[model samples]
Target chain A: MLVIARHTLRETVRKRLLLAVVVLTALFLLLYGVGSELLARQIRERMLTNVDTALPLAASMLTLMGFYITSFLGALLAIFVSMGSVAAELETGTILTLAARPIRRWEIVLGKWLGLATLIAVYLIVASLGILALTRWATQYTPPSPVPATALLILEALVILSLGMLGSALFSTLTSGAVVFMLHATGWIGGLVEALGSVFDSQAMVTAGILSSMLVPSDALWKGASFYLQPVTVILAQNASPLANPFVSATPIATSMLLYSGLYLVACLLLTVRRFAHQDL
Target chain B: MTVAIETVDLCKQYGRRLAVDRVSLQVESGEVFGFLGANGAGKTTFVKMLLGLVHPTSGVAHLLGRPIQDPRSRLPVGYQPEQFRLPEWMTGTETLELYGQLSGASRQDLRVEIPRALERVGLGGRGNEGVRAYSKGMQQRLALAQALIARPKLVLLDEPTSALDPVGRRDIRDLIRALRDERVTVFLNSHLLAEVELVCDRVAILHEGSVVREGRLQDLLKTSTQLRVVVDAVTPAVVEAVRPFAHAVVPNGRSLDIELLSPDHVPAVTRALHDAGAQIWEVRPQQMSLEDVFIGIVRPRENG
Candidate 1:
């Protein structure tokens, strides 16, 4: 398993995927720093009576947007990297030699998952921290719970990674990519429905949203992270408003939902291994 | 001698069609065993079952005395697939190192063995080149190198030389001989009958998911029922006299190619020819090539 993991890492690097990711990440950070600096400058020039409250609100909102985009980048990386893990190898016949080795089939799936998991973890840490640091540098403000927020963001990416890997084992590369993307879109739409439910006070809409989150908990994880990253004032304000908005979570994800997401990740990994073990190559 | 591979009534069914039908075979250690079959004849399916790449629908198979389901069974086995696909981004040495480690070779052993394996396959100093840059023949050599790097007890090569030129095929033939000399069991599957005839000690010919023929190489090719007889005269009476002894007789310039119904009729045909007053110069039995035997076995079944 270690050998396979090492080989996977090496292959990813040699294919230049990692290099492309690094360049794109650097460009994103540059743009983010410039944007945050300009926003901070505009707020400073306004000279409002409640500048003290207005400044922190503006900074937290900007930081939340940065974290949002970081999470999006992380999720895209996770999906594209893992979507071809098994299906591409099988398609190209490269899996024949690897599968014929003495290692068990589960080890192959887990080794690839570990390698990609490491890559995603590192990217999330760097990108999330970079956003937090840049926002603080420009606005002199920080979120109340940055550590838990970043951890939640990483978990969200991992959940998507597991789903992509499972799809790779079960379908062709193109089909796997399409299926995982659709599931991800479903999670995002469900989050929107839940927010609208709160605005309209509709229990039925809220229940449907919760069920969809149960199916794919990517949006739930993001909401959990958003709860950590938001200021107390913003949370109170969002709760007081009757308008629907997808970005702010008035409440944290339930403890049960977080546990379910963990279980969901494990289930996806186990299913991938089982399907690959029984599949004919 | 110990049995390297043993399968008893093993089968594989893809949906309604039975791709492999109750194939039972035993190949001994240190023997070069040839698996012959036409396309879709279940040759690749059988090999995959032995390697545990495909699960058997029923019955059982064992490799090197361990059940195929046991991962340990493949610890001493090496395989070069017919498709011969390698990770294009990896160098030759990296590919060998990866496979060697998966086969449980120590890092120290691979450091020494990788170079030697590459040299054996004629890759030598070119080990650092990526596989994407390699030609078909070079890629084949790299695939063969990885298979042998661990010094496995059994090597399964499917169409081991399909992409090679004549010289490369000869080199592979020589390599097989060298492996046989080292007491490694080689289960070779190839459409090149001539190469099999040159290197295999025993063979099993599969037809429609069944072993139609299996025996020692010499026994399978030795003295078919066709006999060639040279006569001094081209007499009508001589041909007429031997017609009853043979199923068909084609008269050449000075010889008669007679297809006998059985080997028991050899002496009777000689006597009849002598009684017709034709002087016989030479009489010999015909030896069938592997192609002749394969066509004869597969074509008839196909037509029927």
Candidate 2:
């Protein structure tokens, strides 16, 4: 099993797609750091003109910028890392040789998930560190704490990766990636829709938005991460409750999604094993 | 002698088509059993079923006297599939070592045997080279080496010589024959009649998912009493004179083609042809080649 896992990790890590992700992430980080450094230097210089006004607002905006940047990059990495887990193997018949071996099907699935999770973990650490490093270097700004934010980002990535892998099992690679992307996109859309409905007092629209969030809770998790990472005073002043509006706040993902992911992995593995066990060579 | 592999009423179906009908066969230890058939004749399907690469619809297969599905049974069988696809980026050595390890070869054992296995298959120092760089024949040799390296009790080869050149064919045949000397059962499928006729101790001809004829090579070719005689001259008198000893003797200007009743009549027919002022050039008994037998039996059934 370790042999299988090691080989899978090595083979996938060598993929040009993953390499491209690494290159893009590195370039983005360099740009973000350099750009933010310039912006902060200008803000600091402007602070000499208006000492009280510029600094605090700039610090707050900097924190928000870090959150937005990290969240988007995390989501992209999670989706890209797992989109091809099953579908690519099925397409290339690479899985056939391994599945035909004495190893159980679920072991193959678990190994793949573990390998992808490790990849996601690496990207999360690098990107979060990039954000933290940029903020410190640019503005002498250090947010209260980044550990919670980084943890939340990692959790979000894990959830997305699991969903993407499940989608891969059910649909072709392209379809699965598209579905995961759409779910992530619409989950954010639903949050916006719910905010509009509440402000305008549209009961029917509010309910519709809430139901959409329940259907795919990716945005709910992201919103929860937002709550976890934000200073407590901000939430109290805004009267924002993660649970009061499931569409906008990241509530703890239901126990069912976790259970569903476990089941999904097992089912995908069994289907692969049974189908490939007797596959005509 | 113990049978290395045995199948009882093995049957397989794909949708409405019976790919391999009820077939039973036994390949004993130290015998090279040729599975002869045209394309689509269940040779591949049968080999798959035997190797546990595919499930038989209804049958029992025993490898090394244990049930085929039993984990223990599979340990003693090494298989090289007909249309095998290996990882393109893997070096030939890596591919062999991986499979060798999977087949339960110890690292210590692999160290001593890996290079020799490569050399035997003509990929000796090329193990580190990626499979994509290898030609079709070289890839095939590497595949064969992987199959044989484990030195399993039985090697299930499908179309083992199909794409090989004459030299490669001879090498493979020799390797297969060598396996028998090691007391390994060689169960191979091939369309090459001469290959089977030369190396097989016994062969079964499959047609339309059924075994049409099967026996030892000597037994399959043993039944012939016809004598073909070539002479310097052939005339009506020579045909008429030889007619008494042959079922029919037609004069073809230079030779008298005689289909005789028995081998005893060959000498008399030759003497009669010679006595009729015909100079005898050559006289020999007609023996059936595998091709002749295959065409003779399969064509009529196909036509009908």
Candidate 3:
């Protein structure tokens, strides 16, 4: 299993797509690096030299914006990397030799899943932490709860990875990736509907949104992360700002939502194992 | 004699498609067993079923005394799948190393075997080249080498020579023969009848997912008992005289092709032709080609 996991990691990490993504990510970080330096210099000058200037919530808004961009990219990268993990092997008949070896089918699934999961974890930690640290460096302000918010964001990416792998079991690699992305987009739409339903106090509208979230908990995880990243005062400001609506939630995600995310992960993983075990190559 | 591979009423289905019907077969230890079939005849499906790549819809397969699904059962088994694909990023040596790890070979064991396996398949010193750089025939050789990496007791090769040149095909045939000499049971699945004829000790012909014929190659082809004779200065009298002793006679380019009732009739036919003032040039029993036997078994029943 370790051999398979290591080999799987080697296979995915060596792809040109990952290299392109890494290059893009580096460019993104460089731009942020320069922006953060300028913002930090500006904050120091304003806070020390100038007084009586009403400090706008630039840090808070940037925090939300940074996390949103990084998190969305992270989620998409996770899906892109994992979309063909097993499906490509099955399609190209590359899995035959491995499947015929002394290893069991479930080991292949679990090993591959472990490699992708570990990849997403490392990526989430480095990119998310780097983004947050840069934000803090720029504005000298942090989120209300950094650790929980980061954990939820990581979970959101993992949820997408899990669904991508699950889709790979039933469809071709590209189709599975597309399906996971569609489901993710649907969840975002659902989260928006639920947020609107809350403001209007419409149970029917809320139920419709909640049903989609139940199918895939990507939006729930994001909403949960947003709840921790923004304080109540910032939420009030966000409610008034139409531009900030995508990243803002009226209330913290319910604790039950976390349970659903956990269950969704296990369910997708288990189904992948069972389906791949019997699937023809 | 121990059975290295045995299947009892094995079947595989794809929706309404009966890919592999209730096919039963047994291959004894050290036998080079050939599996022949037409397109979509379920040869690959059966092989996959035995290797646990495809779940059996019913029945059972045993390899080296354990059920097919049991991983331990595959410890002594090596497989070269049809249209084999290896990770293109890996060198041939790395590919072997990976399979070595999967086969649970110790470092010492791999150390002793890797170079020898590569050399055996005629890919010596080219192990460092990435598979993406290998030509199709070279890649095929490397696939065979990986199957030999663990020194398995049974090697299942599907279309092992499908991508090879004439020399490469001969190399694979010689390799199969060498495996047979080493007492390794080989399940050779191929549509290449000539190759099968050269190496197989036993064969099973599959038609429409069923084993239409199974027996020792010699026994299955024994009934082809035809003697071809070449004669010089032969006339209609020589042909007519030879016809009495031969069950059937065909004349082409100064040679009379005689279908002998048995081996005993060969001497008599030669004597009759010689007595007719025909100078006998050459005479030999016509061994049935694997292609003929295969066509006989796999062609539609109405044609037969």
Clashes of 1: 0
- Which candidate ranks first by TM-score, i.e. highest? 1
Model 2 C-alpha lDDT per residue in residues A1-281, reported as the tens digit of each score: 55555555665665565688778888877887787777777877776786445554465456566666677777777777667777777776555344434344455666777777777777778877887777677766665557765666776677777777777776788898999899877767886787678767788877877676665555555665565444444446456543343322433335564455345435544665454344553
DockQ, every prediction: 0.90, 0.23, 0.70
Alpha-carbon local distance difference test for all models: 0.91, 0.73, 0.84
Which docking category, incorrect, acceptable, medium or high, applies to candidate 3? Answer: medium
Q: Can you write out model 3's per-residue Cα lDDT over B1-304, one digit (the tens) per residue?
A: 8999999999998899999999999999999999998777899999988888888999999998999989888899999998789888889998999898898887789887999999999999999999999999999999998899999999999999888999999998899999999999999998888888889999998888999899999988876657888888668998899776667888888887887766677778878888888898999888888787777555656376
lDDT of 3 by residue, A161-266 (tens): 8788889998999999999999998888888887788767779979989998997788888877877777667788777764446546756778788888988888
- Give lDDT tens digits, candidate 2, residues B105-160: 78788887789889877788998998889888887887788777766788878887
For residues A145-200, what per-residue lDDT tens digits would candidate 1 score against the true structure? 98998899899999999999999999988899889989988988888898788778
Q: Each prediction's TM-score against the native?
A: 0.97, 0.80, 0.88
| CA-based DockQ, model 3 | 0.70
Ranking by DockQ, best first? Answer: 1, 3, 2
Winner on TM-score between 1 and 2 is: 1
Fnat for candidate 2 (0 to 1): 0.14
